[model samples]
Target: MMKKNYITAFDGLRAVGVLAVIAYHLYPQTVQGGYLGVVLFFVLSGYLITDLLSREYRKNQTIDLKGFYLRRFKRLMPLLVTVFLVTSLYLTAFQPNMLNQMRMSFVSALLSFYNWWQIAKGGSYFANLMAEAPFKHVYSLAIEAQFYMIWPVILLLAFKLIKRRSLLIFSLLLISILSGLEMALLYQPGQDPTRVYYGTDTRLFSLLIGASAALAFPSQDQRLAKLVRARQKGLNRLFLLAMLLMLASLIYLSGQSDVIYRGGMFSFSLLSALLIVLSTQANLYLTRFLSNPLFRYLGERSYGLYLWQMPVFTLFELKFPGATGSWLVLLELILLLGLTEIFYRLVEKPARSVKWQSFKEKGRVFFATPATIGKAVGISSFYTLAFIGIFAMIGIFQAPDLSYAQETIAAQLSQNQTKEKLGQASMSQETIETLSQQYEVSSQVFVQEEPIAIVGDSMIAMTYDHLRQAFPTAYIDGIIGRSGEHGVPMLEETLAQIPDAKKVVISLGINTDGPVILNRNTIDQMMSVLADKEVYWMTINLSQSQYTWTDQVNAELQAASQTYDNFHLIDWYQATIGQESAYLAEDMTHPNQAGQVLYTKMILEALAQ
Candidate 1:
C-alpha cells in the first residue's frame, strides 16, 4: 500500500468528537447528546483500521497479523499503563473513597475487557453519574482495543475465503446488521439499558459499519495509490451535510434513548462513515474551518485529552464540591489542557517514538549525569508512587465492595416482597385500626383498602424491611434507578394488576437532578394518571452542596402537593434535616439502618394525620 495521505480534516473531526465529550462531562445538562462523540469515535476506528488492513492486503497480498497485533500493542499500551499508574496514585493518595469501585476497573482495563467487566457488574453508565469513580471512560477504549485485536484476523480469513472484495464487504454489512438486531432484541424498554450500552456485541455494528465503508471505498487502490477522488465541489457539499447531521445528533441524542438501541446507532455510524470519506480530501470551506490551527492543535492532543479529562473533572468536582459557573468550567478546561499537554509530551508522544531500547539508553544517560540527577529523582519518584498505588489496590482488593450495601438492602427488600406476595397481613384490621387511632387516625379508614401502597426508587428498597413491619400488606414497587418518569408507569401497571391499591406513597425524586421543567411535568403526569386516589410524595433529602438541583426538585414536589387536593407532601427533607450523619449513609442520600426505622415511622405518622 502507498503511504497514507495526511488528511488535516480527520484531525478536525477528532477535535469535534473529543471536545463534545469534554463539554458533556463539564456540563451534562447543556450537552446531553455529546456522548454520541464516543459513537463517532467507534465509527472512526472501524474505518481507519479496516482501511489499514485493506491496504496491507493490497500491498503484500496478505495481512501481517503478528505485526498488526504488535503495532496495536505499542500504540495502545504505554499510555494506558501510565493512566492506570497515575490514576491509581491519585485515588490512593487523595480519594480513597473511590478505590473500591476503581480497583476492578484497573484490572479490567489492563486485561482489555473493561467493557464486559462493566456489563458483568451491571452498572448503568447513565445513572447516578456523580463520578464516584473515573475509569468508566476506559470501557469505550476497551471495545476499540478488542476490535483491533480481532478485526484484522477476520479480515485475513475473509480475504482468503471470499475472493471478491465487494462480496466480503456485503457480508460485513450483514454481520453489522445482525449486531444491531441483537442490541434491539436484548434491550428492555424503561430499564437500565447499560447491558446493551456496555456490550461490545451491541456496539460492534457501529465499528463494522465504518469497516464496511472502508472496504467498499478503499482509500488505497489496487495500484497502491489514492482511490478515485470525489470532485472537490461535490465533496464539500457532502461534508457540510455530514457535519450538520453529526452535530445535530450530538446535540439531541441521549444515552438512555430507546431509539439509539434500535437502528439509531447504525444510522449515526453510517453518517460518520460518510463524513470520513468526505474528509479523505479536505473541503474548500467547512473542512478548512474544521481543520484550522486551533482545532488541529486539539486534534493532535486529542488522545491525551480523552485520557485525562474524566479524572481531572471528577477530582476537581470532588475537591470543590458543587462548584459551577462558566468561570469554573473555564478553569477546569485550562487545567485539563495543561495536563493533557504534559501527558502528551512526557508519556504518550515519547512512547510512540521510542521503543524499550531507546528508553533504557535515555534512562541510563540521565542517571549517569549528576547535573540531571534531580530530574532522574523526579521521574523515579513518579514510578515509585505509581507502584505504591499498585500495592494500595492489592490491599483493598478484598475489601467490602459497594454491593455489600446493596446485598443488605436486597435481603430486606426480598423478604418484604415475599411477605407482600403471600397477601397476608401481620395483624388483623382491628389491630391496624387500633394502631391508627393511637396515632390519631380515624378508625373509619380501616374500612378502605390496605392502608397504604408504596412506589419508589432505591430508597424504598433500602427501607422496605421496616416498611413491611409498619404495613405488611403495603404493595411496594421499588426498583433501583427508578426515576419518576419510569417509576410512575411501573406503579400504574402494578396497581392495575393488584386487588386494591389506594392511598399511595411515592418515593421518587432522587434518581436524577431535576431539569425543573421535566420535574414539574413528571409530577403533573404522575398526579394526572393517579387522580381520585390519595397520594403522598416525599421531598428528597439531597443537599445543595452535593446535587445543585435538589432544591428545584423539592420545590416542585411541594408545589404539586398544594396544586392537587389529594396530593400531600411527606416532608422527609424537613424531618431528616440536620441529622444526616446519624440518619443518612455516607452518600448523604439514602438512609442508614436507624434512618430506615425513622423513615417508616414518619410515613406512618404522616398517613395517620
Candidate 2:
C-alpha cells in the first residue's frame, strides 16, 4: 500500500489492461482480442492480494479480515457508487426504457454477482449481433471481488496447516491445473461460451497462477526478494520472453480462437505471472520501459478508467450517429482519460486517504453546519441537472434504435388486420366479394413465368414480407443466422423447387463466424446452379462494433461483381453506410422496417433496370 512497496512495472501492466479494454469497446476492429486484458487484471490481483495476505499471516499469525474488507471497500466502492448513481440518474431522466431493461443487471452489479446474473439471462459475450449492455464490464469486477473475499480465507487456512511456502505453491498449482481442465471439459462447441467465460470456477486458474507466483517470490520478505533478484541476468531474460508473449497475445488472440477457453486462458495467466515476477526483480529495459511516468500514471488510474469507459462509449453512441471511426475513437480515449483523472483525484484519492473507524463515521464530517449541508445539496442538484441535460441533448440529437419502432408498427398492423377481417366476415356475401376484388386489384403479386429466387441470411428474412409484396411469386429462402458457406446448399434446394426461375438475388455474408471473406468456390458453385440466369450479389453492411471483416467482405463482393458478366453487385454497404443505426436494429447489424424497405426498393429498382 506504500509508495516504497509499489511495483512500478505492474502499474504499466495495468495501463496495458485499461488501454486494451477501452480500445476493444470503442474500436473493436483494432483490438479484436482485447477482452483478454481482463484476464491480465485478474492475475495481477491474485498476486498482490495473496502477497498481502501471506505477509499478514507471517507477522501476526492471524489475518485482519475486518481491515482487509474495509480497505477494499475504501479503494473500490466510492468510484463504483458514483458511476452507478450518475449513470442511473442519466438513464432514468433521458432513456427511461433502458432503466427498466438494466434494472436486473444494475442490481447484480451492486451485489457483485453480475457475471452469474448475465449468465442466467443467457448473455453471450461473443455474439456479434446482440445489443450492448451498459454494465457488461462489471462481470470482471464481480470475479475479482469474489476472489478478494475468498482467496484470503483459503490462504489463511493453507498457511495455518501446511506451514511451508513450497507446499502452498504446489497446492495452488494443482488447483490452477484442475480449474483449467474444468473449463476445457465444460466448453461445448456451437453454444454460447459466455457461461464458461463468466463462470468463476472456470476463471479461477488465472488468479491461482498469480497466487502461486506470490508464494514462489514473496515480495514483502526482504531476504527472499533479494535472493530472487540475485540472478538479475536470468530474471531479465525471462521477463523479456514474458513481455514478448504478452504482446503477442494482445495482438493476435481473439474470442473466436479455439484455444482461448481451452487452456488458452491458463497460458496467458502464466505469462502474466512471469511478468509480475520479472517486474519485482528483473530491473531490465522492459521493466524500466513499463515503469515510465506516463505508463505508471495510466496504470494508477486504471480502475477509474475501466469503470467509466463503457458508459462514456455508450453515451458517445447515443449522442453520435453512425460508425465510430479512428478519429472519434481517439477523441473518446482522450475524454475517457480526462474523466478518469478527475474521478481518481476527487473520488478515489479521497476514499483512499480517509480511514473510517465505523459505518457511523460516514455521517460525521469535517465541517458539520447548515452552510455545508446547503452547499452539499446545491452541488448534488447541479450534478443531477447536468446529467439530465447531457442525456436529453443526446436523445434529441441522435435517433433511437428503429427496431422498437418497427415492432410498434408490426403490432399495429396485426391489430388492424384482425379488425378488418372481423368486419369483412360480418358483411354480406356480395359486398365482401366486391371488397375482395378491390383488394386483389390493389395488391401487387407478379404473374411472370419465371419468378426471382432470393437467398441469404437474416437480412433477407427481415425483408421477406416486403419482397413478397414486390415479387409475390419469388422463391424466397431466407434463413436466419445463415452464413455464406451455407448459401450454395440453400441455393441448390431452392432451385430444385423453382427450376424455372431465371434470376436470383444472393444476400449473403452478414453472419459469418469470424473474419468474413467471400468464398470464391461457393459463389462459383451457386453460379453453376444458375448457369444461364442473372445473379445479383448484395454486399454486407456490417456493424463496426459487431463484425471485424465487413470491409473485407464488401471488397470481395465488389471485386466478384466486376469479374463476372452475370454477377451484379448491389452496394448494401454504400447504401446503409452512415445510416447504420437508423436503418438497423439495436445490434446495428440486422435490418428493421426502414432497412427492409430500403433493401426491397433497391432490388426492385435493379430488376427494372
Q: Number of the top candidate by TM-score?
A: 1
RMSD, one per candidate, in order: 5.6, 9.7
Off by over 4 Å in 2: 93-97, 128-132, 221-230, 358-362, 365-609
Collision pairs in model 1: none
- Per-residue C-alpha lDDT of model 2 across residues 478-541, encoded as one tens digit per residue: 6544665566667777778777778888888766432224566667777777778889888877
TM-score of each: 0.79, 0.68
Error of 2 at 205 (Å): 0.6
Model 1 whole-model lDDT (C-alpha atoms): 0.71
Which clashing pairs does model 2 show?
none
**Ten contiguous residues with the weakest lDDT in model 1:** 364-373
**lDDT of every predicted structure (CA atoms):** 0.71, 0.69
